[model samples]
Target: MRSAIHEFPDDLFTNNERKSGAVLLHITATLYMFLALAITCDEYFVTSLEKICEKLDLSEDVAGATFMAAGSSAPELFASVIGVFITHGDVGVGTIVGSAVFNILCIIGVCGIFAGQVVVLTWWAVFRDSSYYTLSVVALIAFIYDEKIVWWESLVLVIMYAGYILVMKFNSSMQRFFMGKSSKNVANGNAATSSEMEDVKPSKAYSRGSVVMVDEMMNASPSKFRFPEAGLRVMVTSHFGPKTRLRMASRLIITERQKLVQAANGVETQVIDGKVEIENGTVPEDKPTEAEENDTISPFHIPRGVGSKIKWLISWPLLLLLFFTVPNCAKPRWEKYFMLSFILSTVWIAVFSYLMVWMVTIIGYTLGIPDVIMGITFLAAGTSVPDCIASLIVARQGLGDMAVSNTIGSNVFDILVGLGVPWAMQTMCVNYGSEVMINSRGLVYSVVLLLGSVALTVLGIHINKWQLDFKLGVYVIVLYAVFLCFSIMIEYNVFTFVNLPMCMEE
Candidate 1:
């Protein structure tokens, strides 16, 4: 028996499938998916995510390490999982290992350039996480050294990951590695140095992604609050008219305990249930100010069927039984439908991920490219789109620590959970007593290169006082280029493995 993905006859898909119209259609759709991925991630996903981070007072590392990194890396994880089942683990191993290598080398390389300067990272946080990442790589190499996967080996990877996640979550300094109350003083709205942020008072850093405080963002520069405005101009305009009461409320500016008051000389004001009440007819004539009159928010805005779209997006116990609560009602605009927009953007990423995978497979096959090469090169890069985009976005926003941490974080998940989970299930349940056949040749080579790249990155950043510079980025990209050339050569039997001749292309 063989997997459908591994081999296919050229004549099976004739001119009808290849030349008549299907090939062109798939190619066009892939390009469309790429465009859609860019727009949705940049516009909807970034906007809503930034809002939530600000409103909830989530530090960049906390957000990026757990959610942003995980969210962006989701496509890779899922693809690896499905590949495991379909290709009997060949595609999965290649994707996870290759994706980890690609993510570490390329995403950070690209972000380093986009970041425009030395991407400064916290020495302690970087040291801790990078060490953990190094540890995971070591664990992976040790576990897979036997060239077969077992249930316990998979468990080892997963447990190690869980422990690391907990450490990141509970470690106060790590969560707010480059962020704190003093982060308000960052130059031109970037993260501040230790010396620059020394004056601020020590503050408690919370872990859960719940509302912490809005006053933190209020202290930010005006431009800090400036969100993407072009896409939702019509939506914002539609909510504002002479008759419509489109409120301009800001959690960043307003307090929950505030009470509006209108006082007069002849009226006695009293606090009733913490609200001000003035009882007297002899009151001064004070009309509602333009700002005050424009402060009444609508109960429900211009949105429909959010929960129906994705129930998990609404994290309630029983969303079906109760009403779906929109995360925020800021205004009837893009930000208003933050949860909905986020869900839609995430769903689109998933849709585009599989489509991109399919497109890559068919196109590569049509060109007579080897499956192993395509899986490692084209498909691995395709699955990493979200990581590249998300990291670049965070880096450009000056959360360099978050951006860098995301690279390490994604690689950790890619190596451990992405491949480990599938291997565990296959060994424990599917095969019972048999070992899952890993791509030993590719895995061994990839692990060696991975360790080499990780060592280079760690030492380079370590010597630079935890900063990723342009030169370092160039070095990383160059190293990956070398790896790519060697890998391609290996595929063609030019770079020979001592004992694994069959690993070469057929």
Candidate 2:
């Protein structure tokens, strides 16, 4: 399997290679798509939330901090849910907690080092955010003790998130004040000042519909050929144009009753209710016909629930077949199957890791990974390989931020919202008399994750305002070293509270 993955392209000509490649590609793509969908859903949810917040005259900061944080941690939520089903609960718990540790120690630590220097932070924001984050960790630990999550525990988690949001909204005035001064020195100018003016301006209208339309247009493209009164709606542009841009344009068509009207020349006019018009140049000629669109779009746009079932259905059988047949087919002992699985997992991790390292270097060199965001990239880095490949293919020509944001954003998600929510749920289950055990090792790991998160939060607060420096790299390295030590201690039971007596030699 390992060799096959490395030499995948070579397998194209052979029957077995083709089958294996197809399976691998399909499985990998399915997982990536699932994660991407979750991320999109999170964004959608946040968008809806922002609209509600605006309607209630709530602070955007509260809305942003709460939803954006949760949005960023969505993948962890997904993986944990899947883990619950697949591994029955252990992997789910481990993945959530492990991912939290990964988020803080590995993801944040490595990124911080690479980022060079840490910025100075306002102690207030640091204390506030960190205190909430710390409290969350403590809550998680308290819940874990019972080995099951109760409804009340889940409610507590929700309430905690609500509280965090409230604090951000109500106390954001202080943040705005500090940010106002800080912004003057920074090149970006005063965002708060601009926002305040927009808030006070009576004619400054804010429309969720328009925002959604813009977002969709930015995601997808518009069609040149339209439904001619009764005929098929053919798209005369490239079907593979920017997806977000295309989606954005399509959204505009729905909301604004707009049509793509091509002038006698190459200019394309966005005719809205046959009144307002906007020119965005001519559409390309290679767009899909109605039939083509129907065929291609359906296969690609499989619903997440259906797609997940299909993937699992296919994966389980394929795995069973591999287990049953590999031994007979390989002319080797069946026991070697374990070896093969190990080799395959290792090879996949290695190849994936190398690709990630290269991409990170490119990003670091070109963009100089922001000091405040060094830790973010650590989460970004673990799944960096898939993200890099996806970004390169889908939004590479345009939405570069999608890739970076998705990667880093996903990492943050895995930690707070991802791990936190599920752990809360698990606690709920435990309260219902689930026979789950709260392993001491797991508790220790959780504590380590909590500590690391707090440390980083504190560090971020302490260095919120400073420019990027190199000492952060050393701190990250040290933090990671400590993480490794803790991991070894937990995994090996090196120095436990109770020592087992040595067994006599057989």
Give a tens-digit lDDT track for model 2, residues 367-441. Answer: 333111221223233333333333322121122222222233333334446555655555565444333343333
- Report the C-alpha lDDT of model 1 over 174-238, residue by residue, as the tens digit: 43554453433231122333344335332223112332222223232223221111111211111
CA RMSD, predictions in order: 13.9, 16.8
What lDDT is reached at residue 90 by model 1? 52
Q: Which is the leading candidate under lDDT?
A: 1
Q: What is the lDDT of residue 21 in candidate 1?
A: 59
Model 2 poorest ten-residue lDDT run: 229-238
Candidate 1 ranges with C-alpha deviation above 4 Å: 1-12, 15-68, 173-354, 429-431, 497-506
How far is 448's C-alpha from truth in model 1 (Å)? 1.4
